[model samples]
Target chain A: MMRVLVVLAVVFATLPGVIVVLASLTAGQSLAFPPQGLSLRWYEVIFADPDFRDALLTSLTLATITSLLAVSLSALAAISIVRYRSRATALIEAMLLSPLAVPHIVIGIGILQLYGYFGLRADLLTLTLGHLIITIPFALRMLITSLAGMDRQIEHAAASLGATPRAILFQVILPQMKMGLLGAAISVFILSFDDVALTVFLVQPGYTTVPIMLFGMAENQVLPSIHAASVILLLASWLGVILIDRLIGFDRFLFRDGPSG
Target chain B: MQVAPAIRSSRLSRRATSLLLLAPTTLLYLTVYLGGLVMVLVMSIDVPPGVDSGGATLAHYRDVFGSAPIGAIVLRTLRDSLATVAGCLLLGVPVARYITASASRWKGIVLMAVLSPLMVSAIGRIFGWIALFGPGSVIADGLTALFGGKPTGLLYTEAAIIIGLTNLLLPFMVLSVASSRAHFEEDMSKAALSLGATPLSVLLQVELPLIFPGILSGALIVFSLSTTNFVTAALLGGSGRDLVGYEIYLDILVYFQQGRGAALAMLLLVVVVALMALAIQTGVQRHEVRDTAARTRGT
Candidate 1:
């Protein structure tokens, strides 16, 4: 039973990837599984198309900026919440994490409405802000875990040894937070990169991310080009996971100590 | 101990610094997230100016509940979400358990595969499904020929939506369950098996109770994701079955009913939060029971 389940699971997990790769390799104009012939024509088409190239670049840029902003903000917030013990701190923590509970679609609509009112409709900044709101929770959760696990005695000892406040933060605290920072940054990048629902509403003409462009293509018609894009995305994401594991232990990031700990 | 006073002053400074650091995040949450939620809630209550002269009526809520089309969409959304969550849990739990029980190398590979989807965009991943299940696809044609039936396209169907959402969300369940399964000690299971319990019995009686929290969390996450999902439903659900998320998009982007769109968005948010809270409450209750049991044993 276990073996059957494992095989089924592996097949289920790999089916989409396999289909995408096969479809991308189809020699025909339309997508076909068990491709009639094999070719890298779809990949070539994706590369040759200037729109796809631009969208890919935009996605990469947006992900980078959103991840950076989210990581810094969430790290600061997590550190503050942990350091200060107060009644309001719990409320604040809940508020920060509330984005996780709220559906991204509603947030997307809300952001559109809010930004529309402010005359900032359909801009990269709007998408960045929307992505930041969703990505903040992941970074905050990671940083909170890291801060909670950290032994404060070292910081106290540093202070006792005549280290300045900035010195204690930079030299003592920041070094220990390196793993957490990397994990948070990578996770934030992933979240921002994967964001489509939020980006859908905020995206304007000529500023499409890769996902939004893919969505548009799907809506128009499912072509082999979409499959090629999916294959690229899946490979990129898998590469990201491997890169993160190499940089910082993925297990450590996954199984962080809870807030109470 | 003259330095004691200086230490006290430094502590005060540290607090001030922490507060300063927290200000930006706090402000963003208030203005962007919480404020937007509040704005939507308020707008949900307000009657559309051209539709109704009555200010701040519950008419929008009434319309959402009374309209047959909207009500059916909501029901379909809930049903689809529940089915997706159930499917994910059924497939995810066993895989997670097996990975946890297996060698460390296999565990790492399984974990990576499970989490790989999280990195891919929902749009891209759904398009992957489209390629596989869309009209005239090989899978559909193969199944049709095997059954001696016509090749009916699976795209733009409820089944396709469920399948796509389940694939997208299964990793969430696997990761969550894997985390909880890591805490499960093998000794208890072995003891149960030695005491005349079958493997299935051991699983049901011992493992299930311990990992129930993980299951609940995973289900809640999947359900919430499915409920709020627009890309999958829009691409796969076709015109026959409209989800609330897609309807909201249509109202705002297609029909230009911004007020009604906001109203639907608010309703979706409320449902998601309510479900999440229920999940959290169950987890807390389970934790409390475990703690109480441990205390009783200590006594």
Candidate 2:
């Protein structure tokens, strides 16, 4: 009985992805499961549409810049909290992690109102700021975990060998934190890439992310081409998951008190 | 706590370095995220310029809490969210136990399989449902053939919303349960079995108690997420159903009623936070009771 339930749950979890992938290959014009016939026509159609291409580029560029900033800013904060103990460290960490407690829809509405009151244009910069607010917590947590687990003896050993602080940091510390850095970067990238609720509010005309575009299209009518676009995103996220598993061990990453805490 | 002599020589510099490293994140979080949250609270009560002498008003709050239609929407949202929580817990516990009991190699693969849904965006995940259950699809066609009636589809139904939310949130429940079980020792269960306890009795009387905290926390998370989730409820439940998140979206964007929307958002935030606080309080009390029981047993 237990085994049956597990198997059934697994199927329920994965069947949606399987059907979407299969249905995206439909030779038919509209979206439907059990494809009328198999063909690559929809994929070709989506690729030819410059709007999909532009949205993809915008998502990529936004994700790239957002992740880079999130990682750098988080690394600095993580280093300070880990290396230097002070009365304010706990408060600082809590404040940084507070964003995760709020729902995404609330954040979207809040930022929308904030921008409206301040007369700030809803553009790429405003979108990046919103993305940064969400992504920074993940990056900061990963780096803090990595830094907390590091051996202080190594830094002491380097200092004893007449190495300067800069040399010790650049050569000894960063090399040891490779996996943490990579995981944090990938996490922020994936999060910023696929964000919909927050992105929808901040997006302007002709400046939408792929998920938002797919959302708008799906709301009115779902063409088979939407499935094709979804497949591309599915593949991208799948690649990120595999990369994290290879670099950081999926079991360790999943079980850690990371985002779900 | 002995420091290296070379590092100890520059105490002031170390303090400066720490301050420099901490400043940017603090500044950014405060200016944007925290600031926006405060602005939303203010907007929730702000009276429009032409309405009633321009002082702060509770009219939006009154509408949110007092209106019949809005009250029904709130009740519906709570019902659906609770149903989603039930679905997640039902499916999640068995899967978590399976992952925890499996061997090392299988554990990695199983964990990945469980978490794979989270990798796909909610849009992509919902698209799969759209294909599988939309009109003229295989399931609808088969149902129509069997029943000799109108074609039956799950799209835009309450069941679809619950199912989608459960699938999307199962990973969170599983991860929570699995992590809490990570440090659990099997010897206690083994000893219970050796003392003439049946397997079912052992599971119910012993293991369940040990993992109850996990279930509680997981349910709290799943419930909060289910309530606040906009995309899944909106896409699957349709506009006519009107969950609070969707209602807020329409009020702000479609209807241009910012004050009411802000009021609803703040109300949702308060309910979620209060529930979390209540859960934590109960969890702490439970821990103290358990600790006292253990102490008594020791004596």
**Which predicted model would earn the best lDDT?**
2
| lDDT tens digits, residue span B1-299, model 1 | 99999999987877788778888888887787776677677777877776747658777777777789888898899899999998897789888887677765666666666666666555656666777786578778877778866676677789999998898888888877776666566767898899989998899998898778878888887888888888889888877687888898888788887777888888788878998898777667666655654574469
Q: Candidate 2 on B60-168: residue-level lDDT in tens?
A: 9998888898988888888988898888878888888888866555555666777766666667878888898888799878877887677757788888888888888
Worst 10 residues of 1 chain A by lDDT: A252-261
Error of 2 at B112 (Å): 1.3
Ten-residue stretch with the least lDDT total in model 2 chain A? A252-261
**Worst window of 10 by summed lDDT in candidate 1 chain B:** B289-298
Q: Return the interface RMSD of model 2.
A: 2.7
* Model 1's TM-score against the true structure: 0.93
Question: DockQ numbers for every candidate?
Answer: 0.53, 0.56
* Candidate 1 Cα deviation (angstroms), residue A38: 2.0
lDDT of 1 by residue, A69-187 (tens): 99889887887888776666678888889888888878777777777767885656777877888999989988888888899999999989999978987899888988888888887
lDDT of 1: 0.79
